[model samples]
Target chain A: MIEAQTLTKRYGAKTAVDSISFTVQPGKVTGFLGPNGAGKSTTMRMIMGLDNPSGGQVIVNGRPYAKHKAPLHEVGALLDAKAVHTKRSAYNHLRAMAATHGIPNSRVNEVIELTGLGAVAKKRVAGFSLGMGQRLGIAVALLGDPQTVIFDEPVNGLDPEGVQWVRHLARDLAAEGRTVFLSSHLMSEMALTADHLIVIGRGRIIADAPIQDIIDGQSKARVRVRADRPQDLLGPLAGDGVSSQVLEPELLEITGVDPRRIAETALRTGVLVYELTPLQLSLEDAYMQLTQAEVEYQSHSLSPTAPDTTQLTIPVEGRRP
Target chain B: MSAQTTTSPSPTRHAPRPSSGITFSRVLRSEWIKVTTVRSTVILIASTVLVMVGLALLGAWGYAQLAQSINDGSLPADLQAQGPGSPAVDALTTPSSGLIFGQLLIASLAVVLIASEWATGMIRSTMVAVPGRTPALLAKTVVVAAVAFLVGLLSALVSYLIAQPILGSQDLDFALTEDGVLASIINTGTFLALVAVISMSLGILLRNTAGGVVTAVGIFFVLPVIMQLLSGLADWVTDAARFLPGEAGNKMVAVTASEGALTQLQGGLVMGAWALAFLAAALIVTKKRDV
Candidate 1:
């Protein structure tokens, strides 16, 4: 398990990782999610003891990484795919690293075959493609048979087959009761691979929860209602714990009230209700709703108008959940 | 849907053992493997030996030819003895003939040995394995110094053997068993070791191969010349120049007192101080900097 408390890093005047705390538990895959420049890499570096944190501390398996007796066996990290000398061949590179821990040569060959790098194990890394490089990086990360593995952007340059292979590798490793922490900006990949998600924005934790909870906790749910007097119903519906907006001349988007309650109210008030549709939110829409206000870099092409929060009704053909 | 569950038999025995503690010998072995496996390191070692032997042979041949020409009346004897300490010059010539260039080459090799890791982003991997950092640096220093010392000694020996025949042909006796010859060879080897250590320290400090090499060369070559040209400004400057690493190391080999200069022990101490200071600075900087 990896635990970080109040970790922070500052470069000159700018802060890269502002006092963030999180823990990565064993027996499952924890996904570190963030936009570009959101302190994911900096945090990983601190955990590896590569960069000194300006404040706070990070512990791996109850001890600082540098203080561990056998750091390689305790934690294996692939911080960057190209953190290798291009002149050295893959086999020699692994051999050199293996020599440090007195690890046997047989284990090096095992990782080679396991990562499907057998063909290019003898070739120089300079001649390998980006996908090949990622494979080698994974091979090195598994060199010591470490219990806790960290991979940053492991699938950035992989082909589709390689991508599937990495996903399976991560899952299998986690199934063996190891701590698997990976970071990526691809939400779709995270949705597929990560059992838990820690989302950060602008150097701060925006959300930390289970994948299902993150999907369920977003505030984008709404019930769409259509009536002949939608304008007249807006004032009465705009109260505490209930909000209604006019989508069209006859359509009203209502929040904080279920479709059955809206229908009953309309029936009791003698309002002609033609349509009542409940919208189920997608993860993408939830993510947008949560991060739309927290996004730090905005493109010039975005118009001055805010995002449309009003719900539009589609013709009801079936009952909604 | 029914949840299908499939299970495999448990292991008959316990799981594998976790890795044991890290040993210093393992770190040393790792560093040795790293230094010896690189192609550039192999080439540098070979070239250091080659250049030293080649230069020694050339210098020996030239000296022999000059001595013969003077003996045969082809040149003036008074003119040969016109320079002070001509016998001392001829006696000490072959041992230190390859000293200047050999030290430069080996120093450059040492610089690259440490600096290339940083330049290629390999230091991260290295330090991850041995996080203490100082042990790795010390291991490299020991390896580089041993290789350079052996190379320097072998080159001087070869030069002595080759020069022995030429001197015999000229009816001039230059003895390898002589006191001065032995001292000179041992001193030359020690000098090369010092130069290698200095270069390795520069490598650690600069962390750039080219910058480290150039800085080492400037300290050994350019600084002394500049000091000599500005001797009129202050006599202490020239006195200080004698204590420079290269000059001080040469003084140890020649076993001759510099006129109104530091004693032999003082020279040795000066060279040792240089080595200690550079290594210390390199260690401190490495400890503080991010790998």
Candidate 2:
């Protein structure tokens, strides 16, 4: 288990990680989700005792990481894929790391085989592709057989197959009762792999709950309707918490109301409803809704100077004067 | 894709935690592995020994030729008048004559060993394994200093044996039993070991290979030259320069102390003090700063 109490980190005038408190439980996969530079990496580094926290402290398995007599046995972290010396062969690199804790070379070779690095285990890491580097990083993390495993952007440069492998590996480790805390910027990936998520934005905890709760909480029911007159149905649907967007002259997408209600309104308005489909909000959409305002490096859409005003309209409740 | 080969090993459920952990000896072993695994470290060590021994042979040859000239009375009267100290007695210092270059190579090697970890981002892995930070740094220093001492000791011993034949040609050969000769040879190792500690401390402080190398060269090479150029300016300049690490360490390997110069014990203490000071600062800074 990892517990951070008011952990904070500040670089000069910029606060990279605000005072945040959370706990990572064992026996499940906990995903740390954040956008770029949102302090996910910094938080992980702090947990590993690589960076000193500014005001608070983080402890792994009941003590600060450095205080443990056997730190490697308590927590193993792959903070960065390129953390190995490039001049050393992958086999030697793992051996060197294993030596600190007196971990046997047999375990080193075991990790090498488990990570599928046997083919190039003797080759220098300088020649490794990014995917191969990630594999080596994973191998290093697994060498100690720690109770808690932390991976930061483990699939950054992996292929689809490698990505799937990491997902399975994470789940398998958690199934074995190890604390698995993985970080990623992609929420869709978390949706598939994470049992619980702790989302951060701008150095603050935006959400900390089970994955399903976050999806269900932020995603209201949205429906698509094809009618003879979209504006007629939209006018009757205009009320508190109801928003509608006219897609075309006769089609509209409405939120905060179910499809059956939309059909009832369309029928009462004497508007013919040809297509009425209830749209399920993807996790990506829910993630966007959670982080849209907090995105530090928000990119403006292309052609911002000239928008197609006719094609889009604000919800009736949020329309400007 | 090779991902198909990535199989999950059944993690031994509740395997008894191994009793071994990050002890100083284990950290030393880890650091030794790190030092020897890099090909360049082996090459540098080998070259240091070779250059030191090679330079001693050259010095022996030069001293032999000078003695031959004095014997034939072919030298100018003024050149010959400098007396026994010129070639015969000076042969005792030949075993360590390569120290001038040996220290340079050893200093560079020590700096590269520590600084390259930061350059290649390997320090993270190192710090993660030994998060207390001091043990890892201390172990690396011990390993590096031990290697340097062996390099210096072996170089001097080999030089002493190899130079004997050449020195004997001029009747200038000496025994290890000669007063201070054995000490000088062994001190050659002591001197390089001190150089290694100081350079590795610089590596830890700077955390940049190029910057560490430059700073080490400045301390050991350029500072003495600058001191010499300014020694004529004042008596204090000359007096204060004697305490510089390079000046003091040079005296440690001397066959005989010059008039008003530091003795071997004094020189070793001064240089050792400097090494300790630098290493202490490095450890304190590293403990406080983020990796």
**Which tens-of-lDDT digit does each residue in B1-291 have in candidate 1?**
001111221212212245544577777677777767777778888887778778877776776677767667787767766765443356456766788898889889899888988887788777776677787788778888888888888888777776677666665546666656777787677788889999999999999999999999998888888898998899888878888998888776664564776655666678878998999999998987777
Cα RMSD for candidate 1? Answer: 4.1
Which one wins on TM-score? 2
- After superposition, which runs of candidate 2 have C-alpha atoms over 4 Å from their true positions? A305-321, B1-16, B81-84
- Counting clashing residue pairs in each candidate, in order, gives 0, 0
The candidate that wins on DockQ is 2
Error of 2 at B111 (Å): 0.5
Docking quality band of candidate 2, CAPRI definitions: acceptable
i-RMS for every candidate (Å) is 4.6, 5.2
- DockQ of model 2 vs. true complex: 0.48
TM-score of each: 0.89, 0.94
DockQ of each: 0.36, 0.48
Relative to the unseen true structure, what is the C-alpha lDDT of residue B62 in candidate 2, on a scale of 0 to 100?
94
> Which 10 successive residues of model 2 chain B have the least lDDT summed?
B1-10
Tens-digit per-residue lDDT, A159-240, candidate 1: 9999999988887777677788999988777877878888887778888887777876764457788898876566556667
